[model samples]
Target: MELFTLSLPAAIYIFVMAYIPMFGVVVAFKNYKYDKGILGSEWVGFKNFEFLFKSETAFRITRNTVLYNIGYMALTTICALAVAILLNEIAKKWLKIYQTAMILPFFLSWVVMSYITLAFLDHQSGFMNGWLSAFGFEKIKWYFEPEYWPFILNAVHLWKAIGFSALVYYAGILGIDGELYEAARIDGAKRFQLVKHITLPQLTPLIVILLILSIGNMFRGDFGLHFFIPNNSGMIYPTTDIIDTYIYRALSEVGDISMASAVGLYQSFVGFVLVIAANFTVRKINEENSLF
Candidate 1:
C-alpha cells in the first residue's frame, strides 16, 4: 500500500501528460477544422500524408534527415567510446574535473549554443572572418554558405552531445569486473590487448543498446540545432533543412494542423519500424547484445 501510494503521483502524471495526449494522434486523419474540433472534424483518411510526400522538397529533407542522423550516430559513438576509454585510463581526481568540464556544453540549451556558434561564424565581426583578414584572406560569409553547414552542424552537435554519451559509456566500462582486468594483466596482456580483448567486449551490450535507440530517431534531426544555429538563413536551406524544420515551416506558412500532425505521425511510425528492423537484425546476429 505504501509503495502504491509513493507511485500514484508518477502514475497520474504519466496518464495526464503522456497517455492522454495520444488520443490527439487521431487528428492526423481528420481535416481538423477549428470549429469542428478533433472528433467532430471530417476524416480525410491518408490524404494528409500524401500531401507531405508529394512536395518537391520531400526528397531533399528526407535525404538530409536520414544522412545526417546516420553521420551523427556513427561519428558520436566512435568519439564517445574513444573518450570513455581514455577517461577510464586517467586518475580519478582528474577524471572528475574533465567530466565536469566536458558535460558543461551538454547542460547548455541549443538557443544558448546558437549565440555561441554565431560569435565564431558571423561574417563581418565574427572570429572566423577576423582571423581570415589577419591572415590576408577574404572574409567568407559562413551563414549564407550551404556547403559549410553540414560540417558546422555536426561539429556543434558533437561538442554538446559527445560528453554525456561518453559518460554513459564510461559508466558501462566502470561496471566491468576489475578481477577480469587483473587476470588479463597477469596473463601478460598489453594496454591495447586489454582494451580490444576485454573492455570493448564487455561494453558491447551498452553500445548496442545506445546504437539501437539512436537509430529509432533517424528520421528526426535536432530541430534547434538545424533551425537556430543556421539563424533561418534561406540560402543554407539546401544543406541545413531537415524534417522537423520542414514541418515547422509548413505549419507556420499554412497553419495546417492536420498536415502537421500527419507528418509528425509519419516520423513516429517510420522510426518505430526502423527500430524494430534494427533490433531484429541485431538479435539475428547476436542474441546477447540485442535490445529486446
Candidate 2:
C-alpha cells in the first residue's frame, strides 16, 4: 500500500502525458478537420503515410537523419566513455571542477547556443572572418556550405550532449565494487590494464543498454539542433534537413496535421524496430546484457 501510494503521482503523470496523447496517433490516418474534431474526421487509411514516402526529398531527409544519428551515437559513446574513465581517475580534489565545466554545455538551450555559434561562424564581421582577414584568406560563408555542415553538426551535438552521458557513465563507475580494483592492484595490474580489464568489463551492461536505447531514436533527429544551429538556410538543407525538422516545416507552412502525424508515426515505428533488433543482437551476444 505504501509503495503504491508513493508511485501514484508518477502513474498519473504517465497516464496524462504519455498514454492520453497516444490516441492522437490515429490522426496519422485521418483527414482531420478542425470543425469535425479528431474522432469525427474521415479516415484516409495510409494516404498520409504514402504522401510522406512519395515526396521527392524524403530519401535525402531520411538518409541524413539515420546517418547523422548513427555517427553521433558512435562518437558520443566513445567520447563519453573516455571522459568518464578520466573523471574516475582524477584526484578527488579536482573532480567537482571538471564535472561542473563538462556539464555546463548540457544545460544550455539550443537557442542560446545558436547565437553563440553565429558569433564565430558569421561570414561578415564574425570571428572567423576577422581572423582570416588578418591572414589574407577569403571569408567563407559557414552556413551556406553544406559539405562543412556534417562535421560542424556532429561537433555541436557532442558538445551539448556528451556531458550528461559522461555523467551517467561516471556514476556507473562509482557504483562498481572497490574491492575488485583493490584485488587487481594487488596483482600488480597497471592503470591501463586495470581499466581495460576491470572498468571496461564492468561498464559493458550499461553501455549495451544505453546503446540500444539510442538506436531506438535513430530516426528522431534533434529538431532544435538542426533547425536553430544552421539558421535554416535552404542551401544547407542537404546536410542539415531531417525528419523532425521537415515535419516542423510542413506543419508550420501547410498546416498539414495529418502528414505531420504520419511522419511522427513513422519515426516511432522505425525506432521501435531498431530497438528490438539491437536488443536481439545483444541477447545473442550475451543474454545478461540484453535489455529484455
Q: What is each predicted model's overall lDDT from 0 to 1? A: 0.94, 0.94
- Root-mean-square deviation (CA) per prediction: 1.5, 1.1
Write one digit per residue (lDDT tens) for candidate 1, span 74-143. 9999999999999999998898899999999999989999999999998879998999999999999998
lDDT of 2: 0.94
Tens-digit lDDT track of model 2 for 135-242: 999989998899999998999999998999999999999999999999999999999998999999999999999999999999999999999999999999999999
TM-score of 2: 0.97
Segments in model 2 whose C-alpha atoms lie over 4 Å from true places: none
Point out where model 1 deviates above 4 Å: 1-11
lDDT of 1: 0.94
